[model samples]
Target: MTMQASEKTPRQKRGIAKTVAFVVILMTVFVAGFFYKILQPRVMNAVELRANGAIVFDNPRIIEAFELSDHRGEAFTLENFKGKWSLVFFGFTHCPDICPITLAKLAQVYPKLESDIAKQTQVIMVSVDPARDTQEKLAAYVPYFHQDFIGVSGDFLQTMQLTQNLNVAFRKVVQGDDYTVDHSGNIVVINPNGHYHAFIKPPFELARLLTVYQSMVQSF
Candidate 1:
């Protein structure tokens, strides 16, 4: 009877181990299903955010670390784009035509946006010609279009870090006494996560911009 009882004890222990393993597998499946159900809607929304004409990246490109000073002399970094949608343009304060025209068009769209939208969206002009576009000059030039507009300038290498990441091109076209930077005329959209989201090409229309921007923000 002692031998039989000892043999039964080992079988009972094996049965308990099997039950525990089964329970763990069941729990893992249940937890995975719960999370999948919770995340399905968000995954769908991201997919629906895709625009037709705008060049939005499928695999969002992460921006590198860069530090610059805003027109107000406040430090600006990759952190500034966090929790805020940003429209960035790389142009000089001394840009003859393209910069002013682009900024003017942007100004037209600024006030027309809903107060909530305006608060969440920021327009930044990053100077390609940092030598001449000082913080003082940026403060004067940026606000001329809109009071809320921001202008940033710092070391050329730091500025280039951002420009290159965004694929914005700019080169100095030196003439005898004056030089102008020939830059790409496209506005880059940065998502609240500080990732490169989209690029809007030139001849921007106010109504079209507002429509697309609102859609992008909502979907994002």
Candidate 2:
């Protein structure tokens, strides 16, 4: 009996040691993942194309220049809005969800941008649905968000050329007589030089957006 008890004692100790080691490993793994999540800055989700590094500023591929007419049938070239800031957004007024949300956010951020910079920051919304979004429709829909927001529309070919150059992807989808569009949700910043500057993805936080915009424009 004494020999048997002595043997069992070491076996019990070994079992307990293994359990403790396994638990320690699990805890270490859990801790490492938690810290990695928390320590990482700028969580990007459900947003449009986000430019990394210098693409956001200092340097960007300037997709060739083009000319189009505004909602009021006013002719405009890239040279027109120079020497001022412009926030270019591509989406149509017919869009039921993301387009309105994004434009509304821009409306909110617009005043802040004006107050801080005092430069003429034009908000231009280029409609992907030019077939439906006419100049009259544009004039009516655009100003509803912000009076200063400008609406641009052109022939399908002209709009397509501009969109292709800017790298904005859009498609029309129809279901049960209802038509919808899936479009890129990138809100791009154009510098005074009319160059492709930075882009803001969706799910934008007001504060972070403000900070990023301030940093972006100041660098120009």
Candidate 3:
């Protein structure tokens, strides 16, 4: 009886050890899954941004100080870009199709932003054709799309200063008896630090734009 009891005692101890090990593994898996569930949305946002044609810079570019005038005739400098997010588009009021369409799309997206984001965001139209896009012209045009939209224009050299640094290209093409300005259609995103963070390309979709903008802002 003593020999049988000794063998049973050893078997019971081994069974309890196995059960403890299993419990520990189960607890570990549960903790891991809990954390993953919490982190999954952020990971998916980055993926969605890429899928939506947003080009996020690994290292954001610094914007140099350039003086310009807003539609309200206020001085708009690098400081104006500070402390808030700026969505900048380079176009003229005279643009036949692209400018109006793009601005309308932005207008549609602006009101849909979360209140926090809307408060921190500003939509700006920087005139690529400064010769014809005086402050008054911009004032009348930009606000037609959204009441809060800002129109910016300055001397050609000053405009070039901002555009070249931001990698925006614009040129005048002489048509019969007139000229048209051809410019890049991408929307430039400036971070709260007044740095060039990313650009969202053309063929913009309202949902995709909202997603990309929100993801970038929230991640920042």
TM-score of each: 0.75, 0.71, 0.80
Off-target runs (Cα >4 Å) in candidate 1 are 1-53
lDDT of each: 0.85, 0.76, 0.92
lDDT tens per residue, model 2, 31-121: 9999988854433332212332213744665757677888888986778557777778898988888888888988888777636464567
For candidate 1, the 10 contiguous residues with the lowest summed lDDT are: 40-49
Best by lDDT: 3
Q: Give the TM-score of candidate 2.
A: 0.71
- For model 1, residues 1-220, the per-residue Cα lDDT tens digits are 3556456687788997899999999999999999988853222233333443356677778999899999999999999988999999889888889999999999998887767878899999999999999999999999999998999999999988889999998888989988878899988999989999988777687766766666667666
**Per-residue lDDT of model 3, residues 1-220, tens digit only:** 3656456687788997899999999999999999988854342265667778898888999999999999999999999999999999999999999999999999999998888999999999999999999888999999999999999999999999999999999999999999999899999999999999999998989977887888899888
Which residue pairs collide in model 2, if any?
A: 47-202
Clash pairs detected, candidate 3: none
Model 3 root mean square deviation, Cα atoms: 6.9
lDDT of 2: 0.76
Give the Cα RMSD of candidate 2.
13.4
Stretches > 4 Å off in candidate 3: 1-47
Best by TM-score: 3
Ten-residue stretch with the least lDDT total in model 3: 39-48
The Cα error of candidate 1 at residue 114, in Å, is: 3.1
